[model samples]
Target: MSMNVQNCPRCGKLFVKGFAETCPACVKDIEAQYVACADYLRQNRKCDLQELHEETEVPMRQIIRFIREGRISIADSPNLTYPCEVCGNPIREHTMCDSCRQRLVRDVNQMMDEGKNNANAEKDAHHFRITDRLKDRH
Candidate 1:
């Protein structure tokens, strides 16, 4: 059997036989990560989870959990903007936050209404044509 030895730097605990360098009870690494994330956010102002993950090598799920748990705040990014959900336009504050979406919805609704009206008019015209042809034959 091979013997493994390690030392915990924080608690001065001696680990042996397939144990971690840091003791399981010590939370130094977790505290350091929190401090790093906070510092990076304070310096950068605002960043997406993906950007922060790439820059700090933090896991995306952890970052999101941190944000949801009020450990980090997501603000409007001055340097970068996310795309609108509907039109793919860059928005600073919200997703699909643009006048274009409203306009497009209005235009689509109007076109649909016009199409319905035209169909009704066509049906009426067809009825008239059939009636006239029958009268002429009679």
Candidate 2:
């Protein structure tokens, strides 16, 4: 029931925001490109990004997007790799390498632990000054 108006990234047309990003026309075009890329990959399992882009005529950005979105995978092509978002190491899957992922997990866990400790400390310093006053009066 809620409507949001935003400019489409593909054609720059203002449109009611929907599940998919691009407007209807652009969606069709992107779908066509995805199909073409998928077909090309099926035939050429060992292809790299450059060769895939050259052969399929799909943009490298879109191809990378497909990998990020999990629509495409590079397991069969061992040489294929994408830069990690954190350390820029070459990674075959996900945005980060294993070390970066583990580090992030540890950092987040430490933050959560600190938050819980703070909350517990606050609870213990604790309170009920008004309750004590009422009890004394009674």
For model 2, the superposed segments whose C-alpha errors exceed 4 Å read 1-5, 16-19, 120-138
Candidate of highest TM-score: 2
> TM-score, each model?
0.39, 0.67
lDDT digits (tens) for residues 1-138 of candidate 2:
768988999899988888988788889888898999888878888777888889989998888888898888787776667678899887888789999999999999999999999998898678566777799998
lDDT of every predicted structure (CA atoms) = 0.66, 0.86
Model 2 worst lDDT run, 10 consecutive residues: 73-82
lDDT of 1 by residue, 1-138 (tens): 766766777578776624444666555565566677777878776676557778888665555545556666566345444456677665555446669768888999999999999999999877766677789997
**Which residue pairs does candidate 2 place in steric collision?**
none
Residue 39, candidate 2: C-alpha displacement in angstroms: 3.1
